[model samples]
Target: MNLKESEPTASASLSRRKFIAGTGLLLAGATLKLQANPLVSGAPLSTLFAEPIIDIHQHTDYMGRTTDQLIAHQRAMGITKTILLPSGRPVNSASTHFGVGNGLQAKATGNTICYGLAKKYPKEFLFGANEVPDVPEAIEEIERYLKLGACVIGESKFGVECDSPEMQKIYELAQAYNVPVLMHWQYGMYNYGLERFHKMLEKYPKVNFIGHSQTWWANIDKNHLDQKVLYPKTKVTPGGLTDQLLSNYENIYGDFGAGSGLGSMTRDEDHARIFIEKHQDKLLFGSDCTDITGHIDNCLGAKIIAEVRKLSPTKKIERKILYHNAKKLFRL
Candidate 1:
């Protein structure tokens, strides 16, 4: 027997490697398809997913994720375009409040990384500029990114009063840049003072204000008791503060992202449908999840998509919330 006949050639070995790699990707994709079926039901979350989504809010280096993982996560969700919102420069000294948990901190995830990623993956990404609102140079830094073509102005998830002078400056920048501002409105934590936030909304009428987080969502219940309650499971009272803001203020919009966003929608299905139809034009779909696979026992973003689909009265309304609203607001 000739050894050459028995031994695998270099081309054969290369072919085998390619085949194995392809198989792994196929397996992963198949698993995702199965998981997505329950959420999307009729179809899987492929690049051709029904919504043609544009994720208005996402982060780079989120929760210690690698760059490839970050891209993979967005691609897995079938997001048509994504806006990467970087954190402002972290303070050198400790402050009264730095937010809860690892993901909530005001770290210095700068505009450079976001710019680089957006530049490198223009088809997949666009970025937003942000800076620590209280800092003296905050407006200057934010302006720099805005001039550099940041499509949006936040993830303003800092430990400052929502209507503070510092936050006002950021909102002013939004007006100047002619871009929307996405605020993370937690009650006692980040972006404090939801009740007074109306003042800023009034002050910055020309600027589109996108609200996210627990406090903003929880306000959908008129009988909401605690300011710090992240998720309110009570029956929605038809016309809550959130409803009013979305109704009365033309500039105000909702970001259906993260646990808070999903909680607000799913907390009451009946109300969610009404809210979905009524405010279809004012809502934007954003997956603020840090999950790389975009599939889990409970991926907040996927669940929100499902909820919106389930609750939206018409296909047009569902499309508006899922992507059209974000596209028009962000000018993507």
Candidate 2:
């Protein structure tokens, strides 16, 4: 009698409680399997902690998902707070990539939507302002949002160098407002000339720069080849710029979100452990995940959380990466 082979009748409506219970069972089974054949030397998820998470990197309009759904998903993940970043005016290249015209308009709409959500759920949600750095009036636009209580400045996906004159101006604004600037650093996509990004770091000593995406994570390995910064490689070699920057720069931070964040951990568990422990102060937990399910088992965010717990030498460090670091950085 294979119960798995049975089909439900049209009238067999599954209750939400039953669906949640089934999902939990499935996740428990998966956890057991991983524990049996651990991916690393020890089981990373052996001791699961249900600490509150602060997701610093999320969008309001990912895949047309609504604010209601996004909030619900965050609640499901035990995320106590989330910062919503709005995309700035798209560069021509970005516009083509996303199949949208007028990046500024898109950003404005996102800001409005996110602001509304934050107003509606003041404790659970916060919003950021965004503008293409190269555009005229960019500073004015950012100032407007800053005045309106925007906590961060970005998701700055532009087709310009990180140290471009326009970006410098925005950095100045961030310094004035004492707000952190979040950047998506994909080599060819956004923030071109990442190797030279250190110049901006030096120039704006007061502004906190939170890095995200493949290029930033790949550089975690010192021996990461220039050609492979956008690609994920298994096995890591120490001496990457990320470690050096975090060690040296007080204003720079890492956003552990998306495939890039998880890849950095799973690629080399040993190095990851050391890296997290070494730079726990500057590292933050984020979920650039777009899935509606909000289940960590199926999300890269969950994998990163598990890996952080496994690698962290102490429960205190795990809590910092999951919540405290973001809380301190954002002044939450």
lDDT of each: 0.80, 0.78
Q: Which tens-of-lDDT digit does each residue in 285-305 have in candidate 1?
A: 988887777764556666777
Strongest candidate by lDDT: 1
> TM-scores of all models?
0.82, 0.80
Model 2 TM-score, all chains together: 0.80
Over 79-197, each residue of candidate 2 has an lDDT whose tens digit, in order, gives 77789887765455452245343333232245677778898878678989887676676888888888899999987876677887888888999999989999888776677887888
Error of 1 at 278 (Å): 0.8
Cα RMSD to the true fold for all candidates: 7.9, 10.8
